[model samples]
Target: MHPSKVELRVLGTSVTLQEHIRKRAEQDLGIKLRFVVQDGGSVQRDGVMHPDRYELYDQWFHSIDCLWPTHALQPIELSRIRRWDEVNALPRTGRLSKAQPAGGAGCVPADRLFVQADGTLARKPSERISMLPLTHNADSFVYLPDSMPASLVEGEESWAWLLAPELAGRVALQADAAIGAIDAALAVEASGLMRFRDIGNLEIEEIDGLIGTLIEFKRRGHFAGFWSSFAEAAQLMIANKVVIQSIWSPATVELERAGLKFRLARPREGYRAWFGGIGISRLAHGRVLDAAYEYLNWWLEGWAGATMARQGFYISNPKQSRAQMSDAEWAYWYDGARASAELPGPTSKHLVPVGQVRDGGGYVARMSRIAVWDSVMDEHNYLVRRWTEFMRS
Candidate 1:
């Protein structure tokens, strides 16, 4: 590897976000970035057991709980981050200037976020944190508005639609267990098939019950297929004529670009929220470590944030990102107002047409009504094994 190069292993869900920053960082910081994109599960395994292989991990907050116990990540010194104070102030101040909800399975559990004196992990805040919060957003499924039946179209959107008998054989899901299971659990509960005690942190029994239902659905040919990446998810909808499935924001943009019209469903039950950030590998040191710090700072420097904002993702420091964005972009993405003009996506492709309004409304309205946060449940090991079985079934 070149001395000026930094290797980063990031989840596929964030490929566009990283690409938005890669060139800028190389030009401004003089550091070459080599990105290894894979599913979150693979990233988690590599982050925990082979921390030395990558300089940084860009993944969901759940990865912190999975990796910190093994000391796979280094404590991020807040003082080194350019926007450290702002990052720390987000949860308190709320991204939209209101008090955000406290305590949900979707959030990083306080008990597992801090670094201890002996190089272990703790829950309490200190000078160092587990990771530098970056891009985050609420996620939900999407469907073709025209493909939906009149009854469904007239009714409120619900997660139960994923499992509705009317839509069987046209529905799909994410292949990754961590997020897929949660979406499936929501569908199951909404369908009145079963309910979880805590959807975010399912127990062993809940895991089994949910996977069992998924297996039954699969066996019954209730799904068109499963997707491992955003590109794959988009393809599933296009190639298979899938009317509905779990979708990422970028994928939705890609679908629209391909001439497929889709509606991002705002389920009455609430949105599945996720928070992602960058974590330094425990083995990163010296120049590589310095580069890592610079790279992290670059994300908060406003350019990357503005880019992600185009795709409906919220930056940790909206003020900085807003400064980099046009008023139209800010109003459309953050304020959820009708687009004043054609709006571009992360790739700078015009996706939102003039007068188009965001699906879930403003940042405050969406974030405040989160149904669940993407989480690594306590029964994660069991959940994965069962989820694998269902995928194979």
Candidate 2:
């Protein structure tokens, strides 16, 4: 190791840029890790516009389409990742099982993994990759059962409920268009408000139709709020300001700590999924570049993965994190078994009580049911233009 700390600036969203994670990285890697945390949209826009501002970029695979085209991020040499071969098949291939149906629609990680010689990303194997796959999860909306119009039987909760009359004026949506739009589309389709040829990549006509309907609802005061970060989303729930909303899993954990009973819907339509990882800034070099790789390798080395796993996210190298977790934690978080003891969450606090099972079952079972992924559509600019209109309206 270097005699002095090598500082690496990381530009990223709230998910991986968490304070605990930042401190841990600084401690483990013996480097100065600065996390410039922002909302997902801000991270993408900033990374694309000013990649040189940071040494490392951390976000979701969906961001590759935007960052890669601009050459904002450089390709990852997979061999540099110490546990490259240990990464699961979901990111290298589309499915966890050979018999599992294709990982449905949007920027599936496999489709963006390999970096081609033509300075492009592809599905085919190569020495270089677009991003080092890290954490991922199949996400569904959560609701306070008490606030829902009628009691929901677990596994019966539908995305349609987010738009139901009973929750009107008490519903929240994610403020960012790219991801929130997917949640909106899923709810709309589940409610029979409209249908689209491809929900992941909404065509302009579909965007208009979807936005038009949401705008009408907005006019009617259907939404309680639109949140930009996990803290904001958690506040909407913790204060009981909104009963149903799109949320990050960690926000749900916060709700639990606050003693707010909520049901993380195993939506009949299936969950909206996302995968997050790291990319070296295009301008990185020398010590900073080597430090970036160190941070990346550290992420796959189990501690960081274990940290994320505590919050309900699965790491690319599960085996690595599995070794770091307690037997009870592995069973509770991965095997779909009831907690053998009270479980600690992302933080050290033991927020998870014994006997509670994860909302969705095992890793394979939950991942297998993904309906779609957060995406960057072909008409992303147009979608942003229209999405801005929706936000303003």
Candidate 3:
């Protein structure tokens, strides 16, 4: 942590860097830098730091951290870190330390560690996978009974249920423009199956929290509706109001344990999927760039993809998904994993399809595409402003 009197000024256009590095500095150096300003500045161009100009700032700053939102970190830091042969020679550290369950109950390690399809996990010398730790109460609690009926399984009527009738009027969806939640709602309108009523009209004694938003809807004779963050949504689902939630695979597992029935909604509706690829950055000082590249290559080679797929996540390497997973897991991720390869282009088949996705056997098929722009750094301001308008108004 920085010294109490250092009065450090940290100004950056990156949130991940701000959060991670600031916390690290506070913990390691005992210093809390007075953050003077942080804004989307002209200095950040196209989310790429120009070397000639950025090097000066790098020198002034103690450290720098940057990443591409849709993909992985850029090559700048990789290039700078590579020069430190000593850092490279140091033995690999295993995965980040696991947190003990909060309140003395043991924590169950997440079954599948989230890894990037583009091989970010492979770049590290360490063998264990990386996971973003949840900051909330980490303790495991005895949950609601897990009694999913066989009818709710593969062959049941409503097997692929999206939203339940109980949820009709009572939902508060937290949404950003990119993931297309708004479009889905519009589609529902187009289908004429359901009509939405604004929350203000609901009569409730008091509505204070997120849970209250849901309760108010149900009490006023509506199914509360709202989009949710991965962390909080998982907890809510376990408590049992969310009949169906739009979520990624990692969040999906947490809900599944709650026995609150779910299935893919519109995978083919052109939603975004987070993808990552490791690359050398111009800022990496030493041979770290080479090491990072080597690691990236290993991940793409095969085993990494297969292992990740078994965990219900898809990889850039289709062969791994096809060869490594059990038939059940494969069927879960893709309708016909082995046969998907026999189709003209294997990778293309698994990619989230754009527009309408056809019903392929039992799977909710969708094409996958990586949005190339760096929204994490460059466009977050616009997104936040829009979100504020959507919510506060």
Candidate 4:
């Protein structure tokens, strides 16, 4: 019989928030916290959830309570990101401050706006965060590693580089495995660099499921390798199953904590980085939600950026966390450590930015190619169709 999982309804779209709560709840209550994740935003009558609404709902929590830990490693400051528009635009960036306030015609304050940059943001603060609508949220990016390092020297080569026949069944993708796998397949079809047979003998699973799957495969001596989230993938390495897992600088912190020995190797293609952030939930327990707000506030502090910098990831706000950091911390966060790979972001290199919060302490940089969860669902839907076709054929 399944134990009744606590459906503790709290608000926010930040996966870290959920993770924190789950970890805390389990430690305190001795019960597993099962999260029923909804998009972080207000209710929409659009007959569908609006992305902007979700972003706002997430930020609303930041206003009420600090949902994120002040000590968490947010590469950017919410306040600094909010006021980005007043300053010069980021290198190859776009803007997404388009929505009006709820039940009002005037534009939401600039502090609440979201922003997206192609590569990364400028190294310094430009203006006050009090002027923007919301902080910037970074989106996650994906990349493919090749054994033949020379095969990938260009960052813009496309997602096909991951699909060689030698890797067909052996390859594991992140969240977008179905489509990412297909993308790899299509890449192979187009490039004719490799030919793969059926995956009849391969083990496949979603990215989240990959962790357990990899563990299981390791126990059974069937492990190949994996890719996906930077944090968990690093943990996989700690477990010694991540022979060649996908990772980012944030994972480096976890690696250090776990005392794991690993290094980011030079890729045949250039390195790639994905941007992503948390959103507050409009539909949630106000108090618990307030705790989430507190967490976000904590993230905006200078110490948080220092933590992030020490961990190897870039914080959004370069200035707000200044007081919390020592000169040595700042040096380590920005210049002291080397990134795994200096690569372009995963978005189309032409998206806008949005999500300004906390007097410019942190922000979310929107994707150049904007995709809601629905788009991810759509890819899964197509994967189902392909699986159906494959079964029929």
* Candidate achieving the largest lDDT: 2
**lDDT agreement of model 4 with the native:** 0.34
Task: Put down candidate 4 lDDT per residue, 31-136, tens digits, no spaces.
Answer: 3444444332221111023322232232221221122222111223354243343332321123323341111111112212232242222323333121122233
Clash totals, every prediction: 1, 0, 50, 88
When sorted by lDDT, best at the front, the candidate numbers are 2, 1, 4, 3
Order of quality (TM-score): 2, 1, 4, 3
Worst 10 residues of 2 by lDDT: 146-155
Show the colliding residue pairs in model 1. Answer: 106-373
- For model 3, what is the alpha-carbon lDDT of residue 294? 36
Regions of candidate 2 where Cα sits further than 4 Å from its true position = 1-3, 151-155
lDDT of 2 by residue, 1-393 (tens): 681468888998888788999888888878898889888888999999998789888999999999998998888888788899988889888889789987788888899999999988888999999889999999888888776655444347788888987678999999888999999999999999898898899998999999999999999999999999888999998888898898888887888889988877788788899999899998998888888898999998899989998988899989999889999999998999999999998886687899988887899988998899889998888888888898899
Error of 2 at 27 (Å): 1.7
The local lDDT score (0 to 100) that residue 133 gets in candidate 1 is: 74
The TM-scores of all predictions, comma-separated, are 0.93, 0.97, 0.41, 0.42
All models: lDDT?
A: 0.80, 0.88, 0.32, 0.34
Worst 10 residues of 3 by lDDT: 133-142
Give a tens-digit lDDT track for model 1, residues 29-88.
777777777677988998888887788888887778788888888889978987876664
Worst 10 residues of 1 by lDDT: 89-98
Candidate 3 lDDT over residue span 1-393, tens digit each: 214433333223321123433454455444443332222332233224443222112110101112223222232232323222222110112112223111110011121122345544333332233322111110001112233334333332221123334335423333433332233333342334433342111112211222233333345644334443444546556656544444434344455444444444332222332322223233433333333333334444444455444324444345434665555445545553333322211122333222222122322232211111112322334433443444443
